[model samples]
Target: MNDLVCLLFQSHVKMITPMLLKLFIFASVYQECHGEERVDQPDPHIAEFEGRSVTLQCKYKTTSPQPELFWYIQKENHFPKYMLKRNKYGGEDNDAQFQERFDSNVSSDSVPLTIKNLHVSDSAVYYCVLQPTVTGNTRTLH
Candidate 1:
């Protein structure tokens, strides 16, 4: 009777061991797939025009909370310069430059830039920016 009981216990352990290992492996693969997605994920879209409004979409992912949104401009071979600060919901703060040439707003997830009177000189690169709080990372448009 003791021999039969021992045999049954051993078989149960053998059956459970593989299932536990498979569960662990499945969890690891799931984590790996999701992890790769979070690294430097790209935004949905960006648009530009010579004499019309432009909208730049920004997206980000982090381990912690979401951060502020911003707009910036950059010159050739120069560091980025701040243009406007954005509310979390995408409203522009109306900086002097932004108020002069552009009307802007946010709709919870996007920054749409409207150039009231587009000009040839307004053809420089513009960006919609996002800062993710937990990662302390910044994303920009070109």
Candidate 2:
């Protein structure tokens, strides 16, 4: 009876060893690739007059499982202000201060932020940020 029980336990461990190894490999690869997102915003020095509109171009490349896009603005000495973001769930958030003057458009590989009726106080740097969208873990043990 003792030998039979020992044999069963050994078989159980052997069956699970391969699955555990595969899960570990998948987790590491997922972590490494999820951070592979890059955004490009050219025309670092853009100038415009008061009451005029300015559109900043931003393009991004995402090679992760799930990705979300966002836009932010940073003033001279202030922290980045969350202007707007489009989540994976199709929800959108537009800042109250930028309701009428600020607008954003998202395409397949591009998302540009546009400001209308520009004011002197709006002289600041804008940034395009992309992040990984998290859904519930889909991994299941067979």
**lDDT by candidate, in order shown:** 0.47, 0.64
lDDT of 1 by residue, 80-135 (tens): 45777665544457667667876656544455555654555554445555555545
| Candidate 1 segments whose C-alpha is farther than 4 A from its true place | 1-51, 57-66, 89-91, 133-142
Please report, as a residue range, the 10-residue window in candidate 1 with the lowest summed lDDT. Answer: 1-10
lDDT of 2 by residue, 28-117 (tens): 475466645666776566777777777878777776455677887666555556888764456677988778888777776777778787
lDDT of 1 at 50: 45
Cα lDDT for residue 52, model 1?
52
> By summed lDDT, which 10 consecutive residues of candidate 2 come out lowest?
1-10
For each candidate, give its TM-score against the true structure: 0.47, 0.65
